[model samples]
Every structure is written in structure tokens, then in C-alpha cells.
Target: MSAQHFVFLLVKNHTHLTLACATEPLRIANMISGQELYRWSYASEDGVSATASNGSVTLVQHGFGALPPCERLFVIPGLGMTDFITAPLLACLRRAKAGGVAVGALCSGAWILAEAGFLDGMKAAIHWEYHDAFAERFPDVALVRSVFVADERHITASGGTATADLMLHLIEQDHGYDLSIAVSDMMVYAGAREATGEQRISLQSRHGMRNPHVARAIAIMRGALEEPVPPGSIAEDLGISVRQLERLFGRYFNTSPSRYYMELRLDRARNLLLQTEMSVSEIAVACGFQSLGHFARLYRKHFGGPPSSQRGRIA
Candidate 1:
């Protein structure tokens, strides 16, 4: 069979782990199969080279102006992805999609796809840290909690090792389960997660949060970040007394339920502040604060800086 080709557009500050995870699977597939099952190439926005977040540099085989033909074109982006969403990049992607190339994204690259209008009404996944801001910015896109989404024409992985999982899924589809499993064995990637596997650990498992009621309460708190529910209401929903909820919070967080809820909202506010272009006042309102002054004061107290000071995007 003919080799399936893949092209990756590497934006600056892209995470090296996901990039490696994306390509290494293909390499292993070829090694195990003893044939060129897959071919891959790299491109950069400038047609020169791009630097990863960890300071490693990668020279590219092409640039946007000269992207080679491929079966799949994946955008591999990292921090500050919004800044790199330029006309040229979007146009290149649009042309590829228009010409029937399957476009995909890795890591926060889904943000780029959303910006280019590729993921509207599509099931997509992105790195969990960017969920709140991404949801706020692109309401039309249906973002799933899964590590990857593969059934759509525009594929996406939530980054990190999830890229490997997506690649393995493709290998299994094109070749067979045996070759994919061999590739995984060759790479020591046992038990790669399926497409529907969640990106985060259950709240009940992480950070010693063993109490189911507390976990349920935290889930409600996260969902209501934009319009926080009252502690009494959360307790009632959990079928427990308000004082019982407070005790649970004290046991796990050593704080009042209200204080823990405040921290959750502040954390969301911080994510929006750093990952989005939303103004402090808008973020304040988005995080359920009625008064900008109050938001700023609490933000400063919780984060050791005013919301404005958190303006810079992640690098």
C-alpha cells in the first residue's frame, strides 16, 4: 500500500512532548512493519525554524507558503497560540481544507482551528487548562472533556501523550490492531487511552479528594463559575446540610465552603485573564463578581496581584 503522508505546522512555543508523541508513533509503525507505512514532514510559520516551550529548536522542511501535499495537516501549537493566528496561517489552513486535506490540531492548536471556523458545531478537545477560556471564547464549538476527538473531519488531540493515542488510533485504522499494538509495545506506551478517555483525573481521585459529596460539590462549583451557586444550595443539591458541607470542606481544604468556592471562581478568573483578551471588568463579571472593585481586591488578595497584572499569555 502507498504511504499516508502527514504535515505538521509547528508554531513557536509549541510543546515538544506532543510533537514527539505525534511523530514517534509513525516512526515506530514503520520500524515494526518494515515498510514506509507513514511519512511525515514539518513546517513553520516563517519557513525557517520554530522554538519549543522548553527552548529546543526545530528546523522545518517547509513554510506556510510552500506546504507540501499531505493526507493530514495538523497544527501543533503551544503557549500564546492566539498571537500566531494570522491571516496567512488561516488562509493556508482554509486552502488545505478547501482542497480536501483533513485538518487537525494538537494541544492548544484547537484554538487556532476554532478561530479559523473549522470546529464550529464539531466535537473537539483541547488541553484542559484552556477549557474555561476556550468555552467562553467559542461557544459554537462543542468541546469535549476527552483527550482526543477523531471521528470528525477535523481531528484534535488534547496535547501531551494524547497525541500519541490519536496517532495510534489512526495506525490501527489504516493498518490493523496488531501493527498498532506492536508500535505501542516498541514505544513502551502500554494502555494508551481511547478517544473518549477524559483528559483529567476524576476529582474523587486527585489530591486526596475521596469524599464523593465534596467531589460533587466541587463539580457544581466548577460548572457555576460564571454564576456561582450559593453554598446552601450546593449543600442541598448534595443532599447534605450546610454545616455538613462546611465540615467536608474543612476536612479537605481547611477552609469554609464559601472560601473554597471563592478560590475556584478566582482560579477561573485567572485562567480567563491570562488565556483570553477579556478585560478585567468583563472577567470579573464572567466570574460572578458583581463589582469590579470587589473582584480586583479579592483577585489581588488570592493571587498576590491585581487581575490586570495577569494580562500576559502563557509562553
Candidate 2:
């Protein structure tokens, strides 16, 4: 079979780690198979170099308008993705889709695909950090918590090593399981997860121990962030008393149930503040704060500054 061609459009501030993870698997596959299984190139908004978020610069072979025909085009964007979405880039993507080229995204590049209207009514996987804002902004898109989504014409990975997983899945589909395993073994990546694998660690693993009551209560808290359920309500849902909930929180988290819930809401508010273009007041309301003044005071007390001070900070 002919080699599959892939083009990576690296927007400014793109994550460097994800780019390496995406392309390295292909290179290793080719080396292992003793064949040119895949060919790849780079592009940028400008016809020159694209600088990554970590200050590395990649000299690209094409600009957006001059992108070469390829089997797939993967957009690699990172923090401040909104600032990099432009008319030329969107037009290029639209043209590619119109021409029947498969499109995909790495990291926060799902934002670009969503902005270009490629993800409407399609399931996608974006970096877990973008989950809150991406859902709020693009209600039409069905966002899954998986590492990658490949069932549709347009593919997306949650970034980081997830891109590598997606590439391995493609390799397995195009070649065979043996070649994919060879490539993975060569990379020393033993824990490469499948598409249905979730992006974030489970609450149980994160805490290093399992407690069903704590887990259930935290799940309730997370689900009701926008209209936070009271600790008593969460306890009732778990069929436990409020005192038991408080004792659980104090034992496992070293905090009270109310404080734990407040911290959860504030952390989400912080994520929205840094990740989205939402105003502080809008974020406060979205995070279940009815009084802007009260929210600001609590935010300052928790984070050592007001919510407005968090604007433009890198996530």
C-alpha cells in the first residue's frame, strides 16, 4: 500500500510535547516496518516558523494557503487558541473538508475545529482542562471524556500522550496489531490506552485510596458545580448524615465538607477564568455564586487575588 501522508498545522503557542508524541509514533512505525508507512509535513499560519508554547521554533514547509494535499490534516494548537483562530486558517480547514480530506486536532486544537464548525453534532475528545469551557461554548458538540475519538470523519485527541495513542490506533488499523505493538514497544510505552480510556485519573486513584461514600459525595459535588448542592443534600443522596460526610472530608481531604465544596467551585471558576473569555461576573454565576461581591472576596481569600487578576494568565 502507498504511504499515508499527514500534515500538521502548528499554530503559535502549540504544545511541543503533543507534536512530538503525534509524529514520533509514525516515524517509529516506519522504522520498525522497514517501509515508508507514513509521510508527514508541517505548516503554519505564516509561511515561516511556528514557535511552540515552550519557546521551541519549528520551521514549516507550508503556510495555510499553501498546505499540501494529504490523507489527514491535524491542527496542533495550545494555550490562547482563540487568539490564533483566523480567517485564513478557518478557510483552509473548510477547503480541506470540502475536498474530503480528514481533519483532526491535538491538545486544545479541538477549539479550532469547533470554531470551524467541524465538530457540530460529532463526538470529540479535548484536553480535560478545556472540558468546562468547551462544553459551555459549543453545546452542539458531544464531548466525550475519552483519550481520543476516531469513530467520525473528523478525529480529535485530548492531547499530550493521547495523540500518540491515536496514532497507534491508526497504525493498527492501517497495518496490523503486530506493527502497532512493535512501534509501541520501541517507544517503551507499555501503558498506551485505547480510545475509550478516560483522560483524567479516577477520583479513587487520585486520592490513593477508595471510599465509596467520599467518592459518591465528590461525584455529586462535581456534577452540581453550576448549582452547587449543599453538603447535607450530598449526604442525603449518599444515604449518610451530614456529620458523616464532614468526618469523611476531614479524614481524607483534611477539610470540612463545606470548605471542600467551596474549593471545588473556586477551582472550576479559576479554570473558566483562565481558559475561557468569560467575564469574572459570568464565571462567578456559572460557578454558583449569586453575589459577585461575595465571590470576589472568597476568591481573593482562596487564591490570594481577585478573579479579575487571573485574566490572561496561561492555563
Q: Write down the lDDT that model 2 would get.
A: 0.92
Residue 19 lDDT in candidate 1: 98
Predicted candidate 2 versus true structure: per-residue lDDT over 1-315, tens digit per residue: 899999999998999999999999999999998999899999998879999999999999999998888999999999778888999999989988998899999898888999988899999999998888898899999999999999988999999999999999999999999999999999999999999998999888988878999988888888889999988888898999999889999999999988999999999999888888898889999999999999999999999999989887454
Native RMSD of candidate 1 (Å): 1.7
The runs of at least 3 residues in candidate 2 whose Cα sits more than 4 Å from the true structure, single-residue gaps closed, are: 313-315
TM-score per model over all chains = 0.94, 0.94
Q: How many residue pairs clash in each candidate?
A: 0, 0
Q: List the residue pairs that clash in candidate 2.
A: none
lDDT for 144 in candidate 1 is 95
